[model samples]
Target: MSDSIDSPIIIDLPYEEGGKKYDEDIFARALQTETHQKTGQVESSNVTEYHLRILLHYPAVYVIHAEESHSQRSEPEYCVYVGETNDISQRTYEHLYNDPQNRDDWRLFNNHGNMSQYVITHPYFNKSLTLDIENQLMLYMSSVDHVSLPVNKRVNPQRDYYTHDRFKRIFSDIWLDLHRKNPSLFPAEGIILDSALFKASPFHKLSDEQLEAENIILSEIFAALHLESPDQIATDKTNPADSHLILVQGAAGTGKTVLLSHLFYRLLTQTLPEEDAPLIHSPASAWKSDDKHQDGDHASQRNLIPKEDISAYILVNHDEQIHVYNQIATKLGLQNRSGTVVLKPTEFLNRHSRKNDRHRALLNEPIDKADVLLVDEAHLLLTQGNRAYSGKSQLFDLLNRAKVVVAVFDPNQILQSSQRLSPKIQKLLSPADDSAANPSNNGNDDEPSRIQLDDYNNAKPLTVDVSHIRLQQQFRIDASPEVIAWLDAFTDEGIIGELPADCHEHAWHADDSVDTRSKPYDIRVFDSPVDLFDAIKKKAEIKADGCDGKGLSRLLATYDWEYTSKHKNANDPSGHWNVELHQDGTGTWRMGLGGGDGTDNTSHDRCFCQPWNYQLTDPHSHRKGLNKDQAWAEKPYTINEVGSTYTIQGFDLNYAGVIIGPSVQYQDGKVMFHPENSKNKNATNSRKDLGDFAEENLKDELNVLLKRGVHGLYLFAVNPQLQQRLMDVYEASKND
Candidate 1:
C-alpha cells in the first residue's frame, strides 16, 4: 500500500467455492473452475500471487449481503451488513466460524449459501478512515430500498483525519464499482443521496461552520451538565442557570436537520474524550489536528471516553420527517433500547411533563429532567392549545423539562399563527448573525448576541438563558449568489429584480429539455401552469448528475387551494383534493376550473387541474414503497399531485414546479399577501392573543415554495399581476 495508489480496490467474494466463503484467488480460480481459456477443459486452481498481494491483506472496509433465490420481491432485496477491519482475513474467518456462535446476524452469513461480499481496500485506508467509511456505508445501505435489514450496527463516524479530504471521492469510486457489479443490490448513489434518511443520517461530514457549532454546543452541554472533562478542556467556570436554551437560527436548507441528527447520534453513542479508550468508548474523532501523528497514523493511539447516562431526544412536528428521523434512529440502534430518541413535540410533552404542572418547577426544586432535548423545526411548535396538545406553549414546556434545549429556529419559517413566536419572545431570538464572522466567548463560533430571560411564558415560568446562533450559508437552491439575492428580494422585500447575466438559468422548449449535462442550476418561469407541470414531468424523467435513475421533481403551491387529509364529501367520493385553475373564456384568471364561476376550489373539474399531494395513485408506487410515510416530494405518485408548505417544509426538491397561488400577489409596489384568498385556516385564522401574523406567515409560505429546488426551480403564479411582474423580470434579465 502506497500513497501513489489513490484508487480504491474492490474485491468481490463469490458465494461459495467448495464450501469456502471467499475466492482469495478470484480471477485465477474463476478461469480454472469454470473453463480454462486456453484449453476448453474444466479445472480449478487456488493460487495467484498477484491476487494475494491485494486481496484484503491491508486495512479495508467491507460489505456483505444475502439474497434468497426464491424470495417474493419484484426486484432483489437483501439483508446487508457493512464492516471494517485491519486484518481482513482474520475478520472474515471470525464472522464465518466464531462470531455466529454468539450473534444471530453473523449466523446468516455463516450458513447462507447466497451470501456475497464486496471488500473495499485502499492504500490510504487507516483505522479512522475505514471506520468512517464503514459508518457511511451503514447509513447509505440502510436507506436503500433494496436493503431489507442490516446486520452490522457499529456506527463509528470519525472526525477529521489526515486523508479526510479524499474520503468523499474514494467512497464514491468504490460505490460506483460495486453498483456496476450488482446494480440491484447496490443502487445508484443518486437515488440514495436523494433519500430523506440519507439526508438526516449521522455519518454526513460536517462543514467548517457545522463543525465549529458542534464543538461549541458539545462544550456547552458538558458545562451545563457538569460532566467529567478532560485536562485539555476548560471546565473550572460553571454557570448557575437552571436551564439553557441554544437557538440555532438559519434560513431553509442551512444543514440544521443534519446537524441535529449528528448531535443526537453523538449524544447516544459517545461518552467523553479520554486516553486509551476502546472503539465504542472513545471520542477520538474530535481529537485536535495538532495531536495527529507525524505520519498521519494518529488513529493507532487509543483514546477512551468516560461513559455517562446522557438522556437525549430529538423532536420534530411534521408527520413525514418524523419517519425519516425515526428510521435513522432504528437503523443505528438508537431507539427501542432504553427509551425513544426521536419523537414528536406533543408526544414528548405528554410523556415528560406532569399533567398537574401548572407552574414551573422552582429553583433547586425536585423536577423531572432530561440531559438534552433537541428540537428541529422549533418554529412549528404550538404557541397555543390544540386538541392534540393542551400545553400553553410547546417550546416553554420543553424548556421546563430538559436541562438544555437546543432548537433549530427560524422565525421566517413559522407558517401558522399557532406556531408563531410573539413579540415578547421575539426579543430573545433576535439579532441572528453569522457565527463565523462574529465569534464570541473567547473567539469560538458562538454568536455574540445573547439574552437572559428570567420568566418565559407566565403559564409555566422558568429561568432560561437564551442564546442565538446563526447559519448563513445556503445549502439548497444550487444557484449563484445573485440568484439567491433575487429570490430573497422577492420573499423578504417583495421585489422581483432581474437575474444576473451569468445566472444558471434554463428554459425548456420543444428542442431544449432537461438532462444531466452538468448544469449548476436551472431556473425558469412559466406563464401557463400546464406548461410548468409538463416541464416538471420532463425533469422528473431525466436524471441529475451522479445519479442512475430519474430525478425527484414535484409540483408545489402556496396554501391557496383547499385540501385536507380527509375526504371532502360524498359528492367527491374519491377524496381527490385538487388545485384547479383555468381561464373564464375571456382568459380572466379563474380558480377551481369547471363549476362555472370558479367560486368553489374543489369543484368536479378535471381540466387544467391536478390533485393536491396524497390524492393521486402512481403506477410506480410499489417500486417506491413509501413505508406508510414519506416526504411529499420523495414519492413517485406525488408528481401527479401538488404539495404545499406542510408536506415540503424542511425538505428539498431536485427540481421544484411551484404554483405561486393568488394569495401571493404583486400589488402597487411589491408582493402583497392576501390571507382572504388563502384556504389554509392555520395561516388565516385569528390568533387568540398573539397578534396578526398572517402577512408574515404567508410571506414565509411564498419564500419556502420558491426555495425547494436544489438543482432547479420552476415557477408559475396564479395572480395575473404577480405573473406579469415575474415575466417582466425574466425578460429584463435576458438582455444581461
Candidate 2:
C-alpha cells in the first residue's frame, strides 16, 4: 500500500497555456455566510454560536485565495493560504476584517479585492485530524509545479503523525479527494515520497528496528494523551497529572541521542487545533487581554485549555551532548518554537527554580507544567543536592514536572558517585525478569558492588511504573563478533595477569591472523608508547588532509600526569606558558619542567595540557613543526597525548592510541592501581577507600577511554611489567 494518495481532480491551471482546465467550486457554509456578515451588523451571542457551529460543523480544511479586485490585473497566480479551522467562519472573518493593527495583513484582503476559498471535510473530522490533512496538502502543493507556492512560511508539520492510524487513513482519503479536484496543484504519489519536506523529516530513512521502536514510543504517548481531560489545568492549585516513567537502556553508540533528537523535532511541529491554542500563550486569564481576541470571543474562550499538543522539553547534563541536540533541532527547523527547549539539566532546573526571584513572579508554575520530558544520558543525573543543584534529585524533579518521562539509561555510564538517581528510579532501572544479572560471555569475571538506591528518603511517594527497554545492537564500531566479545571481556573483566586457559580458547587462537585490509575493524598492541603515538598522529594528519576519507584519530591515556598552565604575568594573556606535562617521564615525550618563564637554562619542549573541549573548537592545536606563533593553534590530535574523560566522553574517533600510565602496573602477577600517581581528583577517590565506588569508577573510566576509537584501537603500556603481562596474555591465547 502506498503511503500517499493522488488527487483525483485534474485542472489545467490558468497559466497552463494550451492544457485542458478543470474547474470546481469548493463552497463551505462559513464562506457562504461571509457575504451576509459584511454589512457590519453586530452578531448577538446566540447568533454567533449558530455561525460557530456552521463553521465548525465538521473537521474541514479551508484554502483562501488572494485574488486581484481588477479583472485587468496581471494573470492571477495561485498564491493561496492553506489552513485548518474548526470555526472557519470566525477564523476567516478575523483574517478578512479583524483589527488592522494586529491581525493577518494579506494585501489581497486589504484592497477591495475579491477572495474565494475551498473546503475539504470528512465524516470523522476533528480539529487535530483536519490540521493533519491540511499540513499534508500544504507539503504536496509546495512540491508541485506551481507559479508560486502557498504563502505558508513553513510547510513541515511539527508532528510525525496524528494519534491514530485510522484517522491517518481518513486524512489520506481526504488528500485523494483534493487531488482529484485539482490534480495540477498537487504532485504525484511518488513525488510526495521524495518531497523535500519528507527528506528533511526526522523520521526519514530509519531502519526497520528503529521504526518499530519509534512506533512503540509514539503509541505510548498517544495513550497517555488520551487519558488527559480538558478541565484539568496545569495552572490549577491541585495537581492532577498522572506521569509515567519510561526507562530505555543502551550503552554508548546505541543511537539514543539520535532518537531523542528526532522525538523533539516531531513534537515541536505538532499543530494545536483552534481550541488548544491558548495553552501555550501564557495563562488563560492573561490571554483575556489579548488584543486580537478581546471581543468576548466564544471560540477563543472555549480553547483556553488543551487536551493534547502538550509542551515537551529535553534536558541533558553534558554541554557537548546538548550542543549536538541543539544543532539537530535547528536542522529540522524546530529550534524557534516555545513549546520545546534543549538545555543543560542544571540550566533547566535553574530556570524553573523558585530561587530565581525575578522570574518566579510570573512563572511560578506547577511541578506538572511540562507534559513530556526527554532526558538524554540520564545515567548522569545527579542524586544529591549540592551548591550547583539545589534540588534533592534531578530524576525526582523531572518526574514531578512531566506526565511522561523517557530517559536513556546505562548504569556503566555513571561517571561519579554524586551522579546517582533515587532508590525508586534505580529499582525501575534494574534488570527485569527476562534479563540476565550478569553475563560471563561478554566479559566481567566478577560483579561490581550493587548501586545503593535505597539510601534515599522514603517519604516521597512513588506512583510511576519503571518500564524498561534495552537496545543490544552496537552501531558505532564494525568488528568481528569474536573481537567484540574479546574487547568487552578485556575491558570489564580484570584481564591484566595470566588469563585462564578456557578464556583464552574462547576469545583467541594463533590462526586468528589480523587481516587489516579485509577486516571490518583493526586492533593492535604496541611495545612502545611513542610508536603508538606516532601512528596515531600520522593517521590524524592523513585524515585531516583528506588523504584517507576520515578524521577524529586521537591519542588518549589514563589521567596519570598533572596538567598545569602558568602565565608569567597575571594580567598579560600573551605571557601564558605552554601546557606542561610531568611525572617520572613514564608516559610520553615532554618538555622538561625545569624551565621558568623561559629564563631558566632548562629544555622548554612541548608538554601536555587538557584543553577545554566544550568552550573552544580546534583549541590550541597539537600539530608539529609549528613556529612559535603557529604552535598554539594546531590540530588537537597533533598533540602527543590527550587525557581525561572530560575531553573524550560522548565523542567518537576513527583511531585511538591509548597509553596505560604508571598508575596501572603488574605487581605480584596481579594488576594494581597506585592511586597516589593519578592526577584526576575523581580517580583518586579509590585511594583511602579500596574495593568501593572509587575503584569501580576508575575501571569504568579506563574502559570508556579505550572504547573511544571506532575503526581501530592501539594500546601502549608505560609500565614495562604490565606491558609484558599483556603480551603474555595475548600469546597464551594462540592455541590453534
Per-prediction TM-score? 0.81, 0.55
Q: What value of lDDT does candidate 2 attain over all alpha carbons?
A: 0.50
Q: Give the Cα RMSD of candidate 2.
A: 16.5
- The TM-score that candidate 1 achieves is 0.81
| Reference-based lDDT, residue 572, model 1 | 55
Query: Each prediction's Cα lDDT score?
Result: 0.69, 0.50
RMSD per prediction, one decimal?
6.7, 16.5
lDDT tens string, model 2, 568-626? Answer: 42422544322234323344332324334343323233333333222233443443322
Which run of 10 residues does model 2 get worst, by summed lDDT? 1-10
Candidate 2: regions farther than 4 A off? 1-204, 230-242, 270-308, 337-340, 356-368, 421-425, 434-460, 496-518, 544-548, 563-643, 666-674, 683-692, 727-736
Q: Which ten residues in a row have the lowest lDDT in candidate 1?
A: 287-296
* lDDT tens readout by residue for model 1, 338-438: 22778898777767644446543232222457879999999899988787776567887788778789999887888888998778777665654444432
